[model samples]
Target: MKYPSLKNYINGQFVASNSARTIKVVSPVDGALLSEVTMSSAEDLNDAVEAARIAFHKWSKTPIKERVQVFFRYKFLLEKNLQELATICSEENGKTMSEAIAEIEKCIELTEFATSLPQIVTGEVLEVSKGIECRTEHVPLGVVASIVPFNFPSMVPNWTIPNAIALGNCMILKPSEKVPVSSGRIAELLKEAGLPDGVFNIVHGDIEIVEAICDHPGIEAVSFVGSTKVAKLVYQRATNNYKRCLALGGAKNHLMVMPDAIATMTAQNVVASMSGCAGQRCMAASAMVGVGPIDHIIDKICDEARKVVPGENLGAVINKESKDRIEKYITEAEQQGAKILVDGRGAKVDGKGGGTYVGPTVIDHVTPDMAVAKEEIFGPVISIMRTNTVDEALAIENANPYGNAASVFTQNGGVARYIIERASAGMIGVNVGVPVPREPFSFGGWNESRFGVGDITGKSSIEFWTKLKKSTIKWNPEAGVNWMS
Candidate 1:
């Protein structure tokens, strides 16, 4: 399928970079040449920034009703072309078709929420003293930038874009070079929905582009979602430059299966969470803490995982690099004395000889010191670490540097309450596998998993993208008070 446009969308137009450098887009499913995207240079980013600075004056001044109307039309356009966008996302990002469609549907819901910005962006009004009023209003931060990861390309960008734009902040989106097409399509839809030139821009490149965004004086804030290592760097550099930053890093999320937990349901949820998107999700349950005789759970998960057929039930990782990395983790785990229960290495997908497929792999007898257990594999690999008590499981989960997400399976309310309250993770799942907060609630992490003041998505986004200004007013007509005084 042809992409919307292979060029960067800057200044409300599809344009090529000054360097004319191109990154070849390839399909992970079959390693086919999809398209070539123009890579933006520092100079290109400067131009985009200039355009955004100009647009911000008007966009910020635009009435909330008008801004929301544009988003309404954008939402309709998204719904109108849902299938087309979903297909593009799946083909480029190597996710299943249904997964991509579901991502688009979520994006639609986010847009729907954004259309009610007039209500959500409301500030506090209070009466102080006699005839003296005090209130606070939320206003736009100048130019903001968003750096989204390749996994869930279509969905992650919406975590910032709609909220930033709705709050009247001009935005520059830097999509992962691995899957840039989906954001390009979104830029097109934004323009179609009557977004003016420069209000929203897309810049395409790798590290240099990202560094430029951080160091650029024009950018007031930066929001990012990526590996923990990179996120730390982004946070430091952006904040060092005196710009606000919200860097959401990677996770080594754990799914603790208690003895009382339903074996079948726990296993099913584990498999679904760990293997979804080939385990490329940040919230993918890569570690399983087995509290008791969890042998049945592991066996069922391994059995179901082995049956998943690539290109049907599962898809390839983003590229061969990811596939190789996942395989190396598996091999290293075996060498370090961990048992490879079901090896995904060398697994074959039908008619996809060149594809980057790593079938679902499970490793048993994982220890805390094991590299595979500590790191974010970002693949369809689940490792079992047995613990005798709930405290042991909680210790294992909390010891990780990343506090992105964690879940516990139990029938007891007291145990669930204990885990929810004591676990260091930001987003917790009691019975649910992946606890991604919906539109209104903020989604964030703790410790190394997140940096900055506010979270992305939901109401937190409004605060992240806007600044607050307080006003104190007094009117004393009887005393003839001077306005300046």
Candidate 2:
């Protein structure tokens, strides 16, 4: 399938970048050449920032009722083009069709959430003293930007776009060069949804563009989702420039299986957690702890993992480099004495000879000292560790530096509670593998998984995207009333 010409969307128009350097967008599904994205220059980023700056004046003043109307229309247009977006997402990112559709569905859900800003964005009013009242209002920041990762082209960009724009802030988005096609489609849909010109823009590039976004004086705030190393850099640079920033980083999420866990359910959820999206997601579970005697459940997990075929059940990793990196981890773990219960090396789809496929891999008896048990593989691989007690399991979880998410599977509420309260991750689950919070609950992590304050979604997003403006008023001073008199 031929894709639309990849170009920078600045000032509401699809324009070619000033930079001559370009990168080919290859489909991870079959290694087909999808498109060539221009490596947007610093000048191109300037154009986008300028466009957002220009739009912010009118957009920020636009009534909240009117601002939400655009999101309402966007939600409809996203639903209308759901299938096309999903196909683009799956082809470029190498997730399954179902997962791609689910990502777009998440985008739609966030758009729906954005529409509720009219009701939820209200301020507070209280009487501080007699005849004196103070009130606070949520006000939009002028020009803001979001730097989204490649894993979820639609969902991650939507994470900031909906809330930022709905709160009346104009936005410039820098999408990962790997999966730029879906973002172009999103730009078109937002335009169709009646979003005003320059209200939202897309600039495509590599590190240069990222540095530009971080340093651009016109941009008031920045949101980022990527590796912890890069996330920290972006956060420091953006905040150094005195812009509000939230940078979500990498994770090595863990899942604990207690002795009382239902074998079938635990196996299903554990496999799904590690293998979903080829384990490209930050929320994907990479480590599993078997507390007490759960060898029976571990055997079931291995069986389920073996059943996951590359093309049928599991999807390819982002590229050949990612595939090689994931396999290296598996090989190193095996050499370090960890057992490869279900090896995924050399897995492939018959017709997709060039696809970067890696089947579901499980490494058992992975000690904390092993590199595989420590680093983020960012692939469909699971490292299993055994512990004799729940404290040991919780200790393993807490010791890990990345605290994005942790889950425990047990019928016992006390065990679940103990883990939930002690787990260092910001998101916790009982019997749920992926514990991404639903709408209005906020999504974020503690420690290395996240940087800056507040979350990137739900109610927390409103705060990240907007500023609080408080007004204290006294129409007439009452004589000797409180200290103000």
The whole-model lDDT of each prediction reads: 0.89, 0.92
Error of 1 at 311 (Å): 1.5
What is the C-alpha lDDT profile of model 1 across 1-485, one tens digit per residue? Answer: 35543777889888878877778888887877777787889999999999999999999999887898988999999999999999988888888998889999999989988998899778888865556678998899989999999998888999888889989999999999989988888998999999999999998999999999999999999999998899999999999999999999999998888888877788778888988888999889999899978787788888878777778888889988888899999999999999998888987777888789888888999998998899999999999999999999999998998888999999999999999998899999987788888878878989888988778988878878889999987777554444433
lDDT of 1 at 270: 86
Candidate 1 overall lDDT versus native: 0.89
lDDT of 1 at 148: 96
CA shift of 3, model 1, Å: 4.1
Per-residue C-alpha lDDT of model 2 across residues 1-485, encoded as one tens digit per residue: 36765999998899999989988999998999888888998888888888888888899999998999999999999998889999999999999999999999999999999999899998999988888889999999899999999999899999989899999999999999999998898899899999999999999999999999999889999999999999999999999999999999999998999999999999999999999999999999999988989989989999999888899878889999999999999999999999998999999799999899999999999999998888999999999999999999889899999989999999999999988889999999899999999998899999999999999999989889889999988887643378743
Regions of candidate 2 where Cα sits further than 4 Å from its true position: 477-482
Model 1 residue runs over 4 Å out of place are 1-5, 479-485
Assess the local accuracy of residue 364 in candidate 2 as a C-alpha lDDT between 0 and 100: 93
